[model samples]
Target: MATDDIKDTVEYSEDVKVDEKQNISQHEGIPRPEDLKQDMALQTGEADHELRERERKLLWKIDLRLLPTLSVMYLLASLDRGNIGNARLGGLEADLHLEGNDFYNALSIFYAGYVLCQIPSNLMVKTMRPSRWIGITMTLWGVCSTCMAATKNASGLFAARFFLGCFETGIGPSAPLILSFWYRREEMSSRLAVFLGSSTVAGAFGGALAYAVLGHLQGAQGLSAWRWLFIIEGLPTICLGLLAFVILPDYPASAGKRWLSPEEKELAIQRGASAFNTDTSNFDLRQVKAALLDYKNWLTALVYTGLNAPLASFTSFLPTIVKTLGFTNLQAQLLTIPPYIAACFYLGIMCYLSDKLKQRALFIIIVSMTGTLGYMFLLIGNNVALQYLGACFAAMGLYPLIPLTLSWISNNQLGHSKRAVALAMANTMSQTLSVLGTQIYKTQDAPAYRPGHAICLAFTCLTWGTALVLRYFLKKENASKDKQYGVPGEIDEKHFVGAEDMYDKHPGFRYIL
Candidate 1:
């Protein structure tokens, strides 16, 4: 079939709907009127094969153009955000005269700004061009990160960190939301793995980068290595930010005009619409209210909280934790790389499996259990080898969950406004709790930080248990919906007629279990 034929067929079928007066129950095999129209549009044999080939190419083109750009951006964001831990080992605490709890306070303050800005920033991504918004925030955070090199005292450091968090918030929660616009729900986890995997790479890269900067760049131009660390990592982010304006595609509707042919653009939009059940463009208060009222959002947020508390502490203190294992500061930096590399490989595998099996909660439970066991080793192991092994397990377990949880939450939420708000709310609550993670591994707790390990262990277990509970509830809800409304059929625009305000509540919309 010609591209025009495909386009015309889709448009014609979309316009033609079963009569509203016909009782849906009267149709034995059909679940709803919408399915009749959708089935009419279904193609087979050579035409279907050709369409699938086009879609494959389109996805490949999009992934090449979009994923790497966003992944590198997030990698830079992670580097700047977590480099403070590296800087601490490079003598930041001593240079700044950080007292008891001062370092922790500096770490905690970043989340304060991070938590405050996430919801608003995510909402704004809908109104503004995503490229423009992301570019602007990336530039601002780069500035904040670089300015850390100039800080002479704790006050300056605190101020810089807070603003860093504020601007950095734009990227993390916004990425999955942006990806949702372009990819179908089942495709998200693997792509998000690539995006979120950058953070793991950042951990590995940050360690190597810090080692080089601290060893050679120290005392260069009267600046300490820690100062150089800030400047070196921060400058490239600004360049990437400016480049994002030209490189990052906004939404499929707008992006297709630039990169996709007319036929491809229509297919892309249709794909997104089918995945989301509604193409409600304008922001709706009802969607926002639905997101806020969603018990699943709160439950996922709690799960995120459990994951992030350990995540935050782990990223921020891995160097310190390793140092307590009888390694020098430089050796500790080098040692941190392996765990992150391990995590990167593990993350890719789990995400691929998740996307393949179309599963989220089971994998989340598995990884959370892995992390719990890792922390157990840290808590009870008598030797250095075991403790280091625990660190590797911890990295492998915690890093994968970030992308998994985000995509899981995004997959379940319907409509743009509701998904955006749900993502922001989850991030905000999780980041707020991450402050507790920052403070948990105190300086006094060095060399077998049992309490810290125990706390993280508890949180990981909490994550495991919560995933089970969430999966059960989601399964129960899906069963209940099926019993009440019959099994939902393939949803189309007509299915959303009276349910425009319903978002995910539309009878045809079922939660992904």
Candidate 2:
């Protein structure tokens, strides 16, 4: 097919979306800006075979260079954030003399710092660049995590956890923005799954690591096993953070200096064609306000919060929950492994299928429904085997929701600043829910924790309602735009650049459902 034809046929993906306004014929006659002229030629020319081959190579290089490093960074970030749960099982409560609700406050306080830092960290990522910003945050949080080993009382542990949350805030919001910088929208779901799947991997790894440290290092070096757990886990994360500073690349246009060759860099820039370009060059309060005012942003946040509450509960108390099935501490840690493994596999499969089929809402609904059933089983089932089955179902369902919701919103939002602010806002609201989630699995609800299970089931149902409403709104907006214009109106890159602060309001942009 010709360049125009190919552009017309291009799917709604992260890398390329078919714009209804522009035509190949018009593009050939238009004079582009000097900096963009080469990129425009490379795109509009009839070098189909060469473009395809180069694109294939470009994607492979990106997948190899980027995914593994980001995945590992996320893995350590998740591990540090979650290790407190494992340590709780390793006697952190007893060691610190945590009184009634002190432990709960410790968990909840982290989210206070977490909620406060998300927006600021997200805004800073663009200015400081991913390498410096993410690297700095990771290293600092690793230090905080290590200090958890030295805490002498509940207050000290609380302080350590709060700082851990502050430094770790950059990660949860940054991952999706960074992914958008590299992959096409269609390809992002699976890549995001890989990145976010770190949480599940951390669960399995955390359990196994806890089992080993608590089993063998109970008093090694005259420090308790919980202390050893913090030190051992925290040190490697610091090392990884230092490595990320040297290795992680910036956005594509600016990345050749970071890693890629000049030729590869050009390809990378072209991959994120100007049509859906997000301006990360400057900060604007208006963009922040726009994201705050946008209903879609808050709606997605609500759905995400409901889904995420269960995940937070699982991460903090899975071992405790499993132990209620009559297993010892060590046995509970070992038992937590299988469900996380199952969740990991299930997440991979669902992300792959979600991308392949080009759908998000259906998959989210199905996953939420499955999680609801899992909680139902946990609440009502009597047999130990059935309850264990419920645990697997519950865990497998919750972990994938965040990534899917993130990719969904990232797909919908148009501007860089808008997306950045929207994502941070979403993260803020979800973490707020997470704070409430920590309080749900109270010390009073020991063993069966029937109340916690019931709350989770309620939230799962809430997820379904919010997701469907968002889907309906997106469809309505698309339909309305289709009615208003017979075809898409013009979108000059010059005009877009000038008004990037008003992204998604333009007639040319369309929301993907």
Model 1 error, position 266 (Å): 0.8
Candidate 1 residue 228 Cα shift, in angstroms, is 0.6
Per-residue CA lDDT of candidate 2, range 339-400, in tens?
Answer: 99998998998889989987888888888888998999999989889999999999877988
Judged by whole-model lDDT over C-alpha atoms, candidate 2 comes out at 0.84
Candidate 2 TM-score to native: 0.88
In lDDT terms, which candidate is top?
A: 1
How far does residue 457 in candidate 1 sit from its true spot (Å)? Answer: 0.4
Which runs in model 1 stand beyond 4 Å of their true positions?
1-43, 489-499
lDDT to native, each model:
0.90, 0.84
How many pairs of residues collide in each model? 0, 6
| TM-score for each model | 0.90, 0.88
Candidate 2 clashes between residue pairs 3 or more apart in a chain or in different chains: 13-185, 14-184, 14-185, 14-186, 15-184, 15-185
Residue 356, candidate 1: Cα error in Å is: 0.9
